[model samples]
Target: MMNRRYVPDLPEQNALSEANFLRLEKLLGGLKNSHYDFQWFGRNNEPVQVHAEIIERFKFTSTVNLIKQNSALPKPMDRVQLTIRMYHDARMAEVVTWDSGRQLSGVYPYPNDRMYQIDEKAQANVFLGEWLAHLLRHGVAEREWTPS
Candidate 1:
């Protein structure tokens, strides 16, 4: 169970997030069926296969973590995680990245950069697609993360 302090308690927001979660679940389910895989090149130029799988889904949020293929990395790197935070307002939903057991920045994908807002109109599928792509592209080049 997650700590109450970490879980948002807004009822309406939770509903919105739930809807987003459903959409995300559908999206990821499709990806899994298609056998879509993301590749991240390590500092040593070795390729790390990244697989997306849903770990948990709640009323107000959902979690999708990337599993490193062949157990090529350690705990956190072995699984890059993200959370979807639902909102009641027009902003809809927000996706937050987590690493090393800490939230890097809410709704901001890039690490070590100024935190910015995700597009308010973006749906869960699009948000996730872009985020995964960003991870593959910048995570290695800018974040100095090597596949373990």
Candidate 2:
């Protein structure tokens, strides 16, 4: 288990560095069934919380309200919700944008919304492991994640 805390200011150069992504990938790869809760400061200093689960696949649900930081407050009109899905087989990992509040257009199989694939060998920006690592490193967590 690794620390899941929000880092307000991280180095721009290492925003999503390969090393960081590798660390994240290793952490999640060892898990079976688990729930991870994270809290972090988003852009504009808004508090954001991400609830992630690891079952057959990895799912992340994030919520943020630009108008209010308190969770008890009424749902804000400017609330933003994002969902990400990562599915892995024996050969590669595929990441998909399950849902997003920012997109104003069509349904799930959108033309621009294509599944990103990452193979075993680390390539340029196509590494899903690295991407997940970056998210875990920057995304705030309520506590360290422990696999069940």
Candidate 3:
């Protein structure tokens, strides 16, 4: 799965890249029903484990035109916008506000309040795995993802 970091710059691609989106479309189109295991640590410092099955995977167009698109409105929000064609399966991807470096947000699932409570490294790993699994489920190839 191509990590969000490795995804081509969205502005450069305009709306969405057909090649990458098509890759995902073809991959998910083949799957019937399959549960993929994912693991992570919790805010209480415990392990979070779950299995999400592949129901359907497809591409959708979304945008975060400005930094404030991430802002929580009432409060300052820190986040990163991953522009790509994504899926809507059993596990719904959510907006996660985390403190990767300076307080930042991401298009995964996590909250800011507990950001300090969870094991950052472990959670990051788990998040990465889930992100990768989502990509692989859709047949997207893996690529090195680095923060900008």
Candidate 4:
């Protein structure tokens, strides 16, 4: 079995940073249908391949790190880390985050928007897009990462 611990102030950590979000805005502002492949943890204990359209006009903010804890799965899984608003909606200041090590923890609001419920399909699209951008900019080479 896995251990799950709740941490305080998860929302603040996941919110997007200002500079990064501006970069996203610029990219999305001029985006064309470019195909990009990126990998991230899925709800299951495995890597997931995400494919998305690179919109070049949408803006994104930045993210903050939250708690680091283990997953609820057995051995061989990575710890779940939380981030505060990694992205903000242009129309509204909605904060979103990417929760590590947990499956189905897609882009979500951090109690900022009182009535705005996250649509899973939409969240997946946004997550895939934002995550792809992040990986392309910061992902370590596959050859460099070795299992500990």
Q: Which candidate is the best by TM-score?
A: 2
Question: Could you give the candidate ranking by lDDT, starting with the highest?
Answer: 1, 2, 4, 3
Cα lDDT, model 1, residue 24: 43
The lDDT of model 1 is: 0.45
Model 1: CA > 4 A from native: 1-27, 30-46, 67-93, 104-148
The best candidate by lDDT is 1
Clashing pairs in 3: 78-104, 78-105, 79-104, 79-105, 80-105
lDDT-best of 3 and 4? 4
Query: How many pairs collide in each candidate, listed in order?
Result: 0, 2, 5, 28
TM-score each candidate.
0.33, 0.37, 0.22, 0.25
The whole-model lDDT of each prediction reads 0.45, 0.39, 0.32, 0.38
Sequence-dependent TM-score of model 2: 0.37
Please give the lDDT score for candidate 4. 0.38
Q: Which stretches of candidate 4 lie over 4 Å from their true place?
A: 1-17, 22-33, 40-45, 55-148
In candidate 4, position 102 carries an lDDT of 31
Residues 1-148 of candidate 2 have per-residue lDDT tens digits of: 9945433222431343334334434544444426666565666666666555554443432221111133533566333333323223212232332233342222222224453222111232234344355456676556645655
Model 3: per-residue lDDT, tens digit, 35-134?
Answer: 3333444345543333333333345322111111222222342233222223333122221233223333222234455444233433432443344444
Question: Alpha-carbon error at 4 in model 2, in Å?
Answer: 45
lDDT of 4 at 44: 60
Q: Model 4, 72-108: lDDT tens per residue?
A: 4464434333333334554222223434433333334
